[model samples]
Target: MQGYILQIQKIKDEDCIVYILTNSSLVKSYRFYGARHSKITQGYKLDFELEHSMTFLPRLVNTMHLGHRWLINRDKLFLWQQFIRLFYEHLKELNDVEEIYFNVLEECALKLDKQNAKRLFIEAYAKILDAEGRLHNCDFCFLCDYEIGDKVALARGFLPSHEHCMNQNGFDKDEIEEFFKTKKSLNLSDETVNRLYNILLDGF
Candidate 1:
């Protein structure tokens, strides 16, 4: 089966503990000589088998990296890693999550090389919010509980707030509404995208 390596921590000798997110679950497995597996890192996808022993932790074996061209670019890879870690924090406590979670990552990773990572970051986060049933209508202020006027500020999770209510001038309301409806960060400035993406780092 295939899974994304969310995290790996070194143990005694070259052994390590790995946390992986597969289509249906979050898994913790062991790997001896893990240091030798340079391609197995946060944000990299691997196809592998897990060995289970009654008295021992599950073991990772027969791994193959499904590499991406963007991963070799240090900046792109770093952003990808940062985006991937959000899944670990969000899904770590659950034994199972909706397949949409994994699908969102898969879809986003495919486009990482083709689009601006920040744009994809915000758009991917919107996908997650939608899948989880939290992408609310954006016509009102999340804080002040009033109709939003010309512009809207986004709190974490993209809940909309009126710019005046927020004491901040925000992205154009139509653009934000369009983004929520379409899941595209079209027309959002790089500066605007960076702000939205930063909110995502605070986690869903």
Candidate 2:
């Protein structure tokens, strides 16, 4: 199976608990420490086998690291970690997460070093919200139901609002609309993009 390692917590001596997000599920497994044990860490995409036992956590076997070329760049590595940490935290509550979630992670991991990391993250997150049905796609303000004008503001959960409703201004409605329609923010200014990304950081 292939998955991204979301977290690792040290247990008793020579043991640890591993949280992994696979293509279709979130899994928690046990790792017995050993010199030969595959080196696992948060945000690593790896291919491995699992040895399931009746009474113990599934054991990871024959782990192989994949798509780690981004690690060679310090900036990309930092951004990649931040991206995966957010992804893991957002999906931890669900056991049967959609496969699109994993595919997004893989896509982000591969493209992290290819473009502006912040831009890549925001685009990927937009797709995630769309996939999870959390993206607000209406023409009216989410807060007041008023028609959205030239400027807009985004609230937590990516809900669109009139700039005045949020006591903010300067976000172009067309750009946000394009983002919702295409999951891409090519025409948005850096300031607007960062504002949207900040809303995401506030939660969901």
Which candidate comes out best when scored by TM-score? 1
Q: Count clashing residue pairs per candidate.
A: 0, 0
Q: Which ten contiguous residues of candidate 2 have the minimum total lDDT?
A: 168-177
Please report how far candidate 1 places residue 118 from its true position, in Å: 1.1
Per-candidate TM-scores read 0.90, 0.89
Q: Per-residue CA lDDT of candidate 2, range 1-204, in tens?
A: 889988788989968887789989988888888899867777888888889999988987888878666688888777677777786678878788889888988888777766787788888888888888888865789889988878777787778888788887646777777888888878878987777777767656
Task: Give each model's whole-structure lDDT.
Answer: 0.85, 0.80
- Indicate the residue-level lDDT of 23 in model 1: 90
